[model samples]
Target: MFKGNFIQNLPKIYGTYTGGFLAFIILMAIAENAGVSKETIGILFVAFTVCIYAIIGYLSRTVQVDAYYVAGRQVPTVFNGMATAADWMSGASFVAMAGGIYFGGYTYMAFLIGWTGGYVLVSSLLAPYLRKFGCYTVPDFIGTRYGGNLARFCAVVVLALASFTYVTAQINATGTIASRALQIPFELGVWVGLVSILLCSMLGGMRAVTWTQVAQYIVLIIAYLIPVFWISSSGNYGIFPHLMLGDEVAKLGELEATFGLKENSKEAMAAMTFADGSPVKGLKYIVNSHAGVPDGAMAAWKFISLVICMMVGTASLPHILMRYFTTPSVKAARKSVAWSLFFIALLYTSAPMLATVSKLSLMDPSLATGIIGKSIAEVQSIDWYQAWNAQKWMHIQDFDNDGKLALNEFFMRGDIVVLATPEIAGLPYVISGLVAAGGMAAAMSTADGLILAIANALSHDIYFKIIDPKADVRKRLLVARALLVVIGAAGAFVASMKLTSILGAVAWAFDFAMSGLFFPLVLGVWWKRATRQGAIAGMIAGLGSGTIYLYMVKFAENANENIILGIDHLRFGIIGASVCFVVMVVVSLMTPEPDKATQDMIDEVRVPSGKTVLGKQH
Candidate 1:
């Protein structure tokens, strides 16, 4: 599908992508400076992003099997890197990360460390080998390497489970960002997002998703960086927020103290009035409120557990790993991972910094003084309060009879940190719109990858491989497209349920992936002795144990009192992954070794450069 100079053309493509983004920014800035209404500009910003990505999807549309499955296995290293970054970033990294950092504080660094460091596993242990294996999907690698219909079916089940969970979160993020940005109902927003995802993914599969993600990465990175840069410059931190976040952190602590914002204290827990004038308890931002561990060592243990889960989960996620399969070669896969980390690190390092700055700005004495002594009516009249209040993301009530806004009177959801940062920092509404559009890009990009992963697993692994082995390219492509719509709709419906925060849902999906797929996938490539029986058993044990434990602790009887060894449900992936690893090792030792043919296949994949079978076209 592609010949020489594919890599050389990537820089020009990126330049064009950057130029398009800049043009959008300039257009939005012009409208903003011309005094266009913020609401109008925000809607236009979101609409423009969706429409442009849809255009990219249309242009990249392909009916060929190679293009649909792995973008013809010809994506260049740098563009592949950008696409992987976009796929990896997701709504969690773009929208919810700063929010997580804002509420979770120091402990939230786990997400940063886990997600970024996971690429190390990808480069060193996963990507190169998988690319060399020359498979269309993660399950393909498993089925081909291990042999047997049972192995292929089991891999499909795990892939579907993990990808479904992951796609739901990404869709949820899409709805969250769209609802807030477009001023639409969340239910409607979710459907809107579903349409956008289908537009991109249903057209060209991996090919469309790849190009769209590259475009999305540009939008998201710029959207994330601009606000951080603005906030830093505004706070006199110069352009480098990471280097000077210490002062802001200290200032935030001081401001919290001055406002009498003690953790779990009555002052911080003062009851507040809802928009309808009904009274309810105020929200708590205390770190220990949901920590489930009071002691430092226990908290550290929980944090480390989550970090391990995220790291392994990132490496385990099918959509993320699927990106490597699109690259031209094993060496390109390795190089792409390095570039992915470089692109991702730009946002990863800045998230905590933005979180710190946002907290300081929110808790600043000046804003506190302006609101502290104000009536409910007066607080409602405030711009930031009114804007966010309209979305019900923020609520304030004068708890005391003194008719003054106290620290307890102010309540905002964690999600507001990123959404409201531009407004909070006095940036123009255009910047806010751009940020919102950026969030959409992040959500849509990840959703594209996830939907493609699930669709491929179903259409390729299950339907074409087992249900209809005689199916041709046309039939296979249609099956994938049809399944994509079904899966996309299901994701949107689940997302509309609003089960949890963006980060929480994403973490759970990560946990599921790590639990079910991590051990089998990793060992399948690295361990020649890893048998089919072992892979199947390991997946079942890991998924079953993790699911049961999470249910017991999160939704079962006496769930609140059911923490295992002081471990939270979010950190349950470590338990699952551990069980899978042990089970795989034990089962492999007990079972017959893999055949000589399988060993030869493994040896070939171990190499970094080679032509290998991909499909009939190859």
Candidate 2:
């Protein structure tokens, strides 16, 4: 089945992805209807999905340097796009994105717009030209462009920092899925996920990662669509929930109005709290807040700042930029970006709908009407609430000392919304298992891409280029595989700490990538006067400033003072990026222009069609 040209083999791979999943669903339905427990079914679903990815990874393994680094540069556009989309939508995109929207409301539009728009920037400014330039890693582009080892090293440091931060979050997400699916402790689940991540990535590098991501994309798209459609159908929102969910959003607004749940009010703020005697304090209700809707200049400034950060960050991510290197040619790279955006939009557009449908379901009159007047015990009798509470995934307190329940009295974690949707809608256990599999697919696919990005930067850029230029391909491959293990272990360790919010970690990583690399990368390709000195200076300033800003926000007592122009520290990447752009332009003007060779190299990539030079550098 794998013994043909990529075009010829494409259908078979797609068939395997779709057909294998259908078979799993059929078998799971039989087992579930035949009296299998939910836990057993969930375990089977996750195991089955992982097994499929593992098989793909194992079969696609390659020791050849080209295959190891960039999948032989033979991936067709459509398949490459699918792989890129899968890589782009990580664990945060899968599990926490909708939850973020459900909790933060209109403010969260930054994620949707920034992420999607970032791809437009990719196709326009980065993807095709990078393919034409023909580099193994993002740092290779930087080092070669600037003609210095220092540029390369700085690029590697920034890339590793951002990618490692992002990968830890993906690993953390894997643990979250595993713990919920297997009903195991979170720490044990982290190890299970770490082992599975290694199994998928260790053998093949980019070759394994590319094909496995395609399969993962298939699983995740199906997994995401199923529950939303099921809930939509059951709720009479029609079969196409993505198009029909506005009505549900309207219904949610009505319910909020009826319950008098004003998000910005002191009453609403007062309602938020952790479980009684819960070590965590200052946790307020607004589990779903409609607070501080973006209304004026401050809102616009904050929104635009976050959007810019996300857009630049998305375009700057090394793992994502590496995807274009796998495509067959420059034209293929451009075409692949279009397909990538289309595939990603499938989920991005649905996310808001999912958030709305979930909120509507939670506030459905039938399930929630009597709860407002009932005792905590009586509310516990409700199956959905009881099931979620029993798992300790959610906690509801009788805040306000009222014996009866109110909208603010019921506080559940946002993480539980998508995972518990199957039960909330009274769907069968099979669907629940399927959702777990989907979440795992999302996490594993992104983890595979991120780990490869880090491993390649170490082995190819740092080791092969600088440490041991005389090293053979075999030695280089060995180093890469070793780094994969080391990096994966390190990321898993940080993930086990679970210190930051999942989405917060991802956001910070994006901020770091954009701030440090965005100007140096974009200017290197498009601006001829950009010099090594300028690139180096800009990167240090940007990275140093962004890192300092993030540290202050995370650890300093006067963190609030760090907010500039009323923008939060999380959006400070916009400031960092702006600083870098200015520094690069000014420093380049003060320094000598790039050599003629460098200018010609930049011109070579500008051609729409060119040979993609192979090996470590163009």
lDDT of candidate 1?
Answer: 0.82
**lDDT per residue, candidate 2, 461-522, as tens digits?**
89999999999877889999999999999998988998887877888888889888999999
- Output the number of the lDDT-best candidate: 2
Structure candidate 2, residue pairs in collision: 272-284, 272-285
- Residue 231 of model 1, lDDT score: 81
Best by TM-score: 2
lDDT digits (tens) for residues 371-489 of candidate 1:
54356677777788887776567876554557666665567777677888888778888888989999999989989898899889999999988798899889899999999999999
Please list the C-alpha lDDT of all candidates, in the order they appear.
0.82, 0.83
TM-score of each: 0.93, 0.95
Residue 501 in candidate 1, Cα distance off native in Å: 3.2
